[model samples]
Target: MFKLSSTVSQAPISINDSSPAAQASTRLIGFGQTCPQQGCGGASTTLKQLDTRINPDNMCSAGFNASTELCVYSTTSQTACYGDNWQRVGTCARR
Candidate 1:
């Protein structure tokens, strides 16, 4: 068993005039591949990770992060290229 924790400060929500609320609501995506195990839910992606220089795969398991313009869930847990950070350095293959 393992425990992972982090202090993240989320930015305030902004009201946009570009689209409908329903459409924008569907865009606030979070989390990557989640596990039922304890303390294994902090999965995310960052813009730095999306850069090929940092991570080649540059993809997320869940979807995309619009605010940061970074791909989330690109990496998995308990792997070489992944850990608490869970950057998109790793690939999420789906067939």
Candidate 2:
């Protein structure tokens, strides 16, 4: 759990619940290290924002609930890895 400096301004993205996940586009902001494995604290400290969408799949196979959980993936190589918590930003309505 990382804490933001008091001097830094906090502008959190808003969640768009009115629209469906498939219809809405989003940019995921994550502070994750560019490493191969988990447990590596974001020491490399890479702040990335990847454009993605909700991926539809069986909950049993993907290990995520369609009703509650959201599964998104980036077409590029960058991704939100382990140790990257609270990384879900919000919908990109402006874009």
Candidate 3:
């Protein structure tokens, strides 16, 4: 199973990277995960699995993009991880 990772520790590309509605949605999750300094703007969860967040750092060969902030490939058992947990988005080998 591939794990998702977050770039929260690293400086965001820009202050405007996160949207207001996205931020609010994250607050709704409540206590499930830690929000970045700006709060969880791009976090999300789906029926396929648990309440996993979006990982902005895609450093795997799983061919998924964490920047999208969605549980990429999460619909299937493949489980494309991202965000909060600081896990890599794909099961690919990382350099």
The best candidate by lDDT is: 2
Model 3's TM-score against the true structure: 0.19
Cα RMSD for candidate 1?
13.0
Give per-model TM-scores.
Answer: 0.17, 0.55, 0.19
**Global local distance difference test of model 3:** 0.31
lDDT of 3 by residue, 4-93 (tens): 585456753333444333212221111122233333344454322333333234433475555543332222233222342312322221
- Screening candidate 3 with a backbone cut-off below 3 angstroms (N, C-alpha, C), the clashing residue pairs are 4-81, 4-82, 4-87, 5-86, 5-87, 54-83, 55-82, 55-83, 61-92
Candidate 1 regions exceeding 4 Å error are 1-36, 40-58, 69-95
Candidate with more favorable, higher lDDT: 1 or 2: 2
Top of the candidates by TM-score? 2
Question: Candidates 2 and 3: which is better by TM-score?
Answer: 2
Ranking by TM-score: 2, 3, 1
For each candidate, the alpha-carbon lDDT, in order, equals 0.32, 0.51, 0.31
lDDT of 1 by residue, 1-95 (tens): 85549755975455443322221112222334344444555554532122122222234444544344323232323321223222122232221
Mind giving the per-residue lDDT tens digits that candidate 2 earns over 1-95?
A: 88866665766645555434552565666565556576544544666666665555442244455555455665676666544432343322111
Candidate 1, residue 94: how far the Cα is off, in Å: 18
Clashes of each: 5, 0, 9
